[model samples]
Target chain A: MRAYLLARLGWAVPIVIAILIINFLIIHLVPGDPIQALVGDFPTPPGYAEQIRKEYGLDQPLLTQLWLYLVNLAGGNLGFSFANRQPVLPLILDRARFTLLLMLPALTCAAVLGVVLALAAAPRAGSLYDSSVTAISLIGFSVPIFWLGQILIIAFAIKLRWLPAQGMISLRETLTGWAAVADVLWHLVLPGFSVTIYYIAVVARVARASVLDALSQDFVLTAKAKGLSGRYVLWRHVLPNALIPVATVIGYNFGYSLTGAILVETVFAWPGIGNLFIASIGNRDYPVLQGIFLLTAVAVVLANVVTDMLYAVLDPRVRGSYGKNA
Target chain B: MAVQPGNILEIDALSVTYRVRGKTVRAMNAASLTVRDGEAVGLVGESGSGKSTLARVSLGLIPRKIARIESGRILIAGRDATRFSETEWESLRGDPVAMVFQDPLTYLNPVMRVGPQIAESVRRHTPELPLDQRVEELLELVKLPSVVTRAYPHELSGGMRQRALLAVALGCRPRLLIADEPTTALDVTTQAEILALLKDLRRRLGMAMLLISHDLGIVASACERIYVMYAGHTIEWGGAGAVFQTPAHPYTVGLLRAAHAVRNAEGRFATIAGDPPNLAELPPGCPFVPRCSHALAECSRDMPERFDARSGDPHSVRCWLYEKPGLGFDRAGTG
Candidate 1:
């Protein structure tokens, strides 16, 4: 197990670096100049743009700039955002917390709701409840996340007025401690739910299929014959067997939601990295974009590694295979 | 004669039907059998002969949605259990009755350690006992090493896995144990060992057993009495030696011939002609009539009820040939 963990962490290094390189190349490839975006659209003094460009080391050759970027990354310096003129690390870090606040609850709720509904539906697979669960999941899966977010805002925020339509909190409130947390959570409802729907559908669909499969396995018959209650059999024999695939979906979606938050954040105007990411693209702030992309890549890699570890934990066969390979 | 102390189980005219696609197909048609206290009974049949269905239904283990018991009585120790609720059945299971299924690898939870799988039943039935010690005792009872308790199903060999499954069944100390094709999934050599172990456990533990098998040889070695089923009906039943030596029903004869043909490799391998009738569209007569070589005109017109095939003996058969004394088809060892 120790060796497996070490091997996974070792593989994560090159993958994150590769993603960083791609992010750098892609940011540079876009057909716009950061200097022009940073300055006004009107013509600048001839040497003025050159002075600002040299100040940020942008006047260096492409390869030299790439080399300097890698060197700075190695030294843990993310440089400055072109638009904010602030350290990119602190700027992205400040927004990351808000994004996490939105995502963690959404992911947790999605996983719990998915597995619970799947367990309820699997035993009565042909019943109306099963069909309804399948149909709702299908609808949730097909609807676009941004569109769903808008629809939720319209219904809950505008029409019924049950929730705040946008933002992470009621900015006017001078709340603190518990009140502050409650206010933030209250404002988080629409966006968090919007983010949750798609993942809930994905996880439920996968979990339901696996649960049905687990129900039909021979061990399930053995469990039933043991006089265990249907609930006990489901919880002990069926759920554990079904969860490996559900965990895969949950982990993959959890990682993807880091970047996936863009639509939800934009729709709700939540002050997260997703909002920063969008604004950075318009301002052609390469450093901020690259930092967010690099962070997302590292997070995705970490989620996948954690998912692999979870697989070993859930299945003894997988754990044994990993031990042998290690 | 005084009534025997109530057979461990008495399945009377048990009929089960499965809803397939849109049609209800009868899986077990008035099948019946009994397992006396401490007696090992064999239920022999071809595929789709409802052997497994009988075993599963006896334990109330069949899923209610896929299959339903159309009519019958399942008497457990003289009490009618046909109307027993799920909760009542649950209590009865793993205490009065427990089952060992066909394939251990599939029947044993792959992710669960051997120790816990066995202990699940043990804990429920004997919560007063120390769980660890009981688990160790079960593993030892099945002739497995104590270290095997830590391993998962896939880690064990086929023979060892089946033993672990047996241990799971034995953990409950059930009075009546049902083993449905228990050795069907094992290799030939392993098959003998598992069967021997099952017989040894039955003898030592004094549990009544209902052994279901498609192979006549496996059942004969481990069981004292045999019940023969063809397509859903229990066509013949008697002492194992009587049924094997002077099998009355043509289907039973065919099964014995098939078993003997395999052993006698020098002779041409004999196989029963024609497939078993489909339960969905069975003819209004004996199901075996279409395949029986000695089928009479009357056999195609009506299904015969059980009749005495041997005088002063318990042997019985569901065949028209046994209705009269001078039927030439009653000759033994024709196969």
Candidate 2:
């Protein structure tokens, strides 16, 4: 167990460093300067621009700038955002919470719904129910996240009036505590549900195929002949064996979710790090960009390590294979 | 008379028809048989002879929601088991006719230890008994070493696992046991040990058996009476000694020839030509007609009923040759 923790920590450190370097390079290599982006795009005098450049240390060479950025990062600072004047880490953290409130519930919902439907429609795998689920999944997987977000906004929020339209919450009360929590959940419904549709389609199809294959194994037959009920065979013998594949998909999807893949976040106007990251690219905000990228990189690596650990817990065979012999 | 003759299992004219690609496929064609107290009967067949299907039906392990008995009866302990409810079957299966599968490790749950598995079945059927005593008795009965109960299934050797299964089988003190290719997964040495253990259990407990296997030699060694199935039909039935000494039907002859050849290097093993008939596309006459070298011209024209050729012993054959000769009947690989 100690070894597992060490290994995970080992893989995560380099990932953060790599992301930091990449983020630093990308923002620096951009055509425009952060000093100019902070002031304005107007045709100002070269002398005025040069002083602002000097103040921000942008006039220094690339290596000197990179070294100072690292030193500043080491001194307990993430730097103020060029766009908002807020500390980068705090801004990113607040946005991450909002995105988490939206996407996590949707991800979890997708996993549950997908697994249930897949198992129910598995035995007659190519039958009407299976095909219908597959077709629905195909649509869910293919439809653009932004388009889906718009459709939900138009149909449910505008036409049906079943839900509120744009923005994070209603403009009525002081948005904090209970009201804040409820408001986030309510606004999150459309974006979260829409994003979840893709996961559902992918997860359910994977679940059904795994279950069908697991049920065909010799162990299933043995379970049945031992006088266990059909339902028991399905729940015990089939599901545990079937879950290995579904778990893999869900784990990888969890890592991908941390990247804050931009489409859903933008559609919802989510103040997530991905949105900040994208804008930073345009304005060449090197410090904020590197901070967000490093954090995200660390998150993805940690997620994979957690997934591997979860696998060993769920199936002893995996742990056994990892140890005994190989 | 004779303490009510503890005939533990009875399977009468049980037929199973499966639907595949919108067509009804007759997997079992009115197959009838029985197992009385302490009698080891072999349901011998080549592949696709409906041997596995028959075993499944007997155990009520068919996979579907609305399964039809199709026709016939299965009586266990004087109760009609043909339409036994799931709950009723669950109650009766482990206690009355515990089944031993071909592979023991697959039969035992991998995550569970050897002792707990045996304990589970024991607790299910014999709930009144104390745990340790019940386990120890079972271990002693199967001739497994005492420490086996604590070990995981993977820890034990193949022979040990088979013995462990037997201990579980014996946990119920089942009147009849179904050994479906019991020794098929083991080496020859381990095979001998398992067979010896089974024979000893039967002798001591008077446990009747319904053994299904492709190995004629194993069946001949273990069973008292033998029933030969070919293409869903029981083509021949008699004592094991009689069947082996004088196999009347062509398929039985092929099986005996195959088993006998394995013993000696004098000649190539005799083989039946063609694959077993597809259950979905069974021809009108015998299921073996396409593969049987002894098939008649009329064999494909109509279904062949039983031909009880040998008198006074119920030794039967399903073929056209017994009725009349020279309708282009040719018995190859035989006299």
Best by lDDT: 1
Error of 1 at A100 (Å): 0.3
**Candidate 1 residue-wise lDDT at A303:** 96
Query: Which residues of candidate 1, in runs, are more than 4 Å off?
Result: A151-162, A173-175, A324-326, B1-5, B262-267, B330-335
**Per-residue lDDT of model 2, residues B85-140, tens digit only:** 77678767776778788888877766556887787667767889998898998899
DockQ of the candidate models in sequence: 0.77, 0.27
lDDT for each residue of candidate 1 in B134-251, tens digit (9 for 90 to 100): 9898888889999988899988999999999998988888999999999999999999999999899899999999999999989988989999998889999998888887888888
Please report the candidate that would top TM-score against the real structure.
1
Q: Kindly report the docking quality category of candidate 1.
A: medium
In Å, residue B184's CA in model 1 sits off its true spot by 1.4
Separately for all candidates shown, the number of backbone clashes (residues 3 or more apart, or on different chains) is 0, 0
C-alpha root-mean-square deviation, each candidate? 2.5, 4.6
lDDT of 2 by residue, A1-326 (tens): 45555666788778777777777877666677677677787888769978877877878998898888878877867877777777887887887776676667877998999988888888667788878988888788788878988899899998999877766778777788987888877887777788888889889978988988887776666555556666776776688778878888888787768555577777667667667777777777776777777677766777788887877666655556544432
Residue-wise C-alpha lDDT for candidate 1, range A233-266, written one tens digit per residue: 9999999999999999999987877778998999
How many angstroms is residue B16 displaced in model 1 relative to the true structure, after the best TM-score fit? 1.3
